[model samples]
Target chain A: MKRRDLIKGAGAGLLAAGTGIAAPAIAKGVKQWRMQMTWRANSPLLATGPQLVADYINKASNGRLELKLYAAGDLVSPFQVLDAVADGTLHMGHGYPAYWAGKLAAVQFFAPIPFGFTSQEQNAWFHYGGGQELADEVYGELGVKFLPSGNTSVQAAGWYNKELNSIESFKGLKIRSGGLGAKVLTEIGGVPVQMPLGEVPQGLQSGAIDGADFVGPFNDMAFGLHKVAKHYYWPGWMEPSAVLDCFINKEAWDSLDKDLQEIVKGANAMANQMVLSEFVTKNAQAVKIMKEEHKVDFRLLDPATLGHLGRVSQSVIDDVGQTDDLTRKVYASYRKFIDTVQPYSELSEMAFMNARAQLKS
Target chain B: MKRRDLIKGAGAGLLAAGTGIAAPAIAKGVKQWRMQMTWRANSPLLATGPQLVADYINKASNGRLELKLYAAGDLVSPFQVLDAVADGTLHMGHGYPAYWAGKLAAVQFFAPIPFGFTSQEQNAWFHYGGGQELADEVYGELGVKFLPSGNTSVQAAGWYNKELNSIESFKGLKIRSGGLGAKVLTEIGGVPVQMPLGEVPQGLQSGAIDGADFVGPFNDMAFGLHKVAKHYYWPGWMEPSAVLDCFINKEAWDSLDKDLQEIVKGANAMANQMVLSEFVTKNAQAVKIMKEEHKVDFRLLDPATLGHLGRVSQSVIDDVGQTDDLTRKVYASYRKFIDTVQPYSELSEMAFMNARAQLKS
Candidate 1:
């Protein structure tokens, strides 16, 4: 039978089941699915993103596809979301590709890289440039289908207990960083340690780490990083923009009808837009609260320090690009796209922003 | 008797009409819609945006709702789209709020303002920070439902025949500009003239204007602006980001089922994301092609010139804010949001972009 016939058959079944019920009629036999998210409970934007996606899909589909979400460690450990989705234990998983960086180095490029594409540039590359195709090739091999579901705008460098006035400050500094940032930090003479999000504040308090790089001000403030670290730095060169992905079991995705597939794609796109906008607004407000209430010192990475870090980052990118064939391909495509877009962005977004800074308003 | 009963009644009618047909089944009596767009036939991203929205809705709704698009002048003049939709002559219209700036001064704020929010920040404010609510208040009064459908990332300052080295150069300079940017330009020493997009290149060529501010490289290249002017300036501060909107007849929109309404919203959201990404990629490619193939002279407004323009922009904003009560409310809210967001943006987007510029990569 054709796909439409199958959908009609499902609808007929649903109509029979829904008869005599007071609940609103759905499209067809309600497909109940569970999604596991990597974000911890109450993780601000990260946690909110998955719920938003589920809500959009459920409402837009008129409850035809109901998606129930489980926070990190609710159903399974955060790290196991991908595995569960791949094994058909869960229909979908929401997490960053960088979470699986250990399983595949190329996956890191799919999330974020040091001195990489900002949120806008990254989305441009993913959707219009060849980033999505590369991601499909990588994820397809792992028996999963991936879609970029959310983004946190450029993250802050980190919250620091002491002033970082010069390049010398990075030497031997134990910073809680992750993904490609960790790699770049190590190359720049910093001791980069990857710790759980919940452990970062405690680590800083106990002097286990000098500073911790999380997301931007919204998530940063939620973790109360400003209370522990008096100085908040600028220009998060590492993971400039973090992308969240929704992974589905390949079999489960292929089984859906075309309309259902489009619904899923449309829902995810809305979630991506909404989540980023939420971050921008929330981060802005968070910065204000931090400044007024906690007396946080906003610091920019010195030009000289940034220059040195940039050089080291380039070296790190080059080393990673040499890892394997897929990694090389992904890196080459990313580098070319970024290089092509940078000049325009520098002249446009960069220039306008700088000009606005000089304004009295 | 109830909403579901009404829909079921419509489905029964469709079933009677669709008897023995091999075509795929739609939701019910398929609702056909006509969308008139303000963009010209060959307009680049602007024209493509409406088509993308229509395609998404048609496919996602399984043709239950089919949107037919008519380009500018195809059905009515470009500026008449909003009026057409408002009067139910068309179900929907795609245009920018700024087009109706003459009719309602406050409408311009919903589009792009001089030295206003960037695309990301604009989206943030519109979706999360009361922009949409204000827009509803402004547009709903006209019997239209508005949604942001597309965005062109920061436009170029304009195409100039002579280098703008100082604020003095702007004296007596007649540039083809529009909206709030034109207001700001007039305040600062230049003569800002409003003209159709088609007239800009010729105006610059025939010395009718000294320079013209159109969109960024992609659309600007399409207009062959480079052939008339050699100096391509940085930062289209006039419209840091231009937002395109879709206006639906309020009565027609309210008539849609909850699922169909969600579908329309989802389609427009996708279009917004897609259009912005397309601009980023295409604009970057256009810049590369222009530099290698056209040798356009890229210039940045000198710091002194930028500073002087920034000061004048503030005054213009102040004057515009005092126009009327509604305009005052819109301007006040816009200023408050921008102020609250500026510091975070300065430390995040601005700092990262500047730092990336100094990078070896």
Candidate 2:
């Protein structure tokens, strides 16, 4: 199957070529690799990362390298995204960086820290700023090379069972949060539970946790979050911009031809955008359904509680710094960067908000 | 047209309501004016912005307030989002401050001054660094109140027609570029043409322009730039991190019920992630098409030319500074910001590239 032949087939052939199955055989007479994503087939980001890259490389090299993708749970469990990619069981995995934080503290920053950067800023940091370097350094230590695969802008706080009238309401409440947000929540007196996506609905139903936080309305609705937790909270300050990753085995990545490497990067970039746009269009319908059809009560954490959480977030960062040297380096860099820009944000964004609120009221 | 009737009809109705047709009818009996957006239909940021005050006023008045979403491109072009909302064209427009650089010199800095600041650092600037004050002063002049809607990550440079080999190739070339990049390209002796999304392909096809630049692969592919141009470029240095906005008409926004304002802001927050993620996923396939079918050439501009362009860019900025106070203020701020963090970018990003290229050869 020549590269042109594989491409001509389109659809399933495109899929097959993308995941690396018969692509190399049919295309450029090169090598093929397969990656089974942890997200559902409907997930544009998860389904297409490898596919897009494979197609690009196949086309670029006239079929020298191909990658085939398998939907979530097809080749491995969803939770295995990072592990599969890390151990070379899979060539790559598309998931959040924080999922691998246990392996490296710096991974969490790649995704989101409490009250961290938004998606746009994070991308700038990683791509143009010193972010990708830091990311590469951290992940390189573990024999994995990371590509930023997805970025979810400021997210909703989470789904709640009731309104948060004050900071005290957080005490004793059990909620599911990820990355370093769990630590922030814990600091604010809430009990934090970390669970995989598959377990969320069950957790909510069985009362294992009081509430949960996921990507946003599109995913939340797709996962039927509104069905379980009726009160959706807002201002996901803890995870303002959630970034996902495409973790490829370093050896496997380096082994690819130059064209193949470019393809992989190109494909990841495509997947990142698709996921972002789909959510933009689809989430609206989903949220509307949840609000009107299902009667979900959406709420924002009280201002006081939000402020308290922000303070707690600072302590959490400090705590992480105390616990790990790598964490200290990343956090220190982040802190210094934050401090330099703090005055600007205060005068520009904060002042406007304060002035507007008073004048409007 | 009633809120109940609209909600009962669902998605399409909400979309229609967003165009302002249904808001009046719905406002008759609604105690709570809630707005949904395509960005994030019912998120909390909406409530915090104009909608929050709208809700308050509606509540105070006992059911006369109706808040609804101003979906992307609902009342006007998405690019004109901020202006529409600010000038009371509609109660709100999804404000992407990054897009308004043409109007105000300083707006770019407030958004993300190309290759500057990570998302976290941006938030720091807006919240604590006095950036917010500067941004508000700008927006205040425009008769609008602004809040962080959401942010995007670093974007790709753009799709191009041919691989650039040397600085000479830029001379007499007409290409599609925008914002500060137009100036940068102009400095390099190239003619930079600005065209909205609809006009790019025609410009490319008619040779009205040699190439064009836009969001990233996700968006570029959607427009099928791969089909028109054979070369795709990278390192979206011009718009390292573009920020989207949720614009509100000062007077009308101020008049909105409180909860409704928060709804708008919250939805913008939600939109932020959706847009970011969409770009990530979509670009993969677009680039694939470009590589495979279009046989698009992927090349980075030669370092000498890139360096030359960078130098010219400074001159352009300097020239802008000589013309207007706002331009000078913005340039000074931007220059100071860039100078402060450039050492890090140099040591990390540029240095790594230099080291890696040596290793590559």
Give the true-contact fraction for every prediction, in order: 0.85, 0.00
Q: lDDT per residue, candidate 1, A206-230, as tens digits?
A: 9999988888898788888887887
Over 4 Å off, model 1: A1-28, B1-27
| Model 2 ranges with Cα > 4 A deviation | A1-29, A44-62, A341-361, B1-361
The per-model DockQ list reads 0.68, 0.02
Query: Candidate 1 on B1-361: residue-level lDDT in tens?
Result: 4844654454355345542112232546688877878986647888878988888888888888888776776655788878767876678889887888787778878868778899999999988899999988788877798898989999988999877989888889999888888888887779988888888988999989998888889989988999999799988888898888998889889888888898899899889999999999999999999999998888889877888888888788889888999989899899999989888888888999999998745
What lDDT would each prediction earn against the true structure? 0.84, 0.58
Query: How big is the positional error of residue B95 in model 2, measured in Å on the Cα after superposition?
Result: 22
When candidate 1 is compared with the true two-chain complex, its DockQ is 0.68
Quote the positional error of residue B86 for candidate 2 in Å.
35
Q: Report the TM-score of candidate 1, chain A only.
A: 0.90
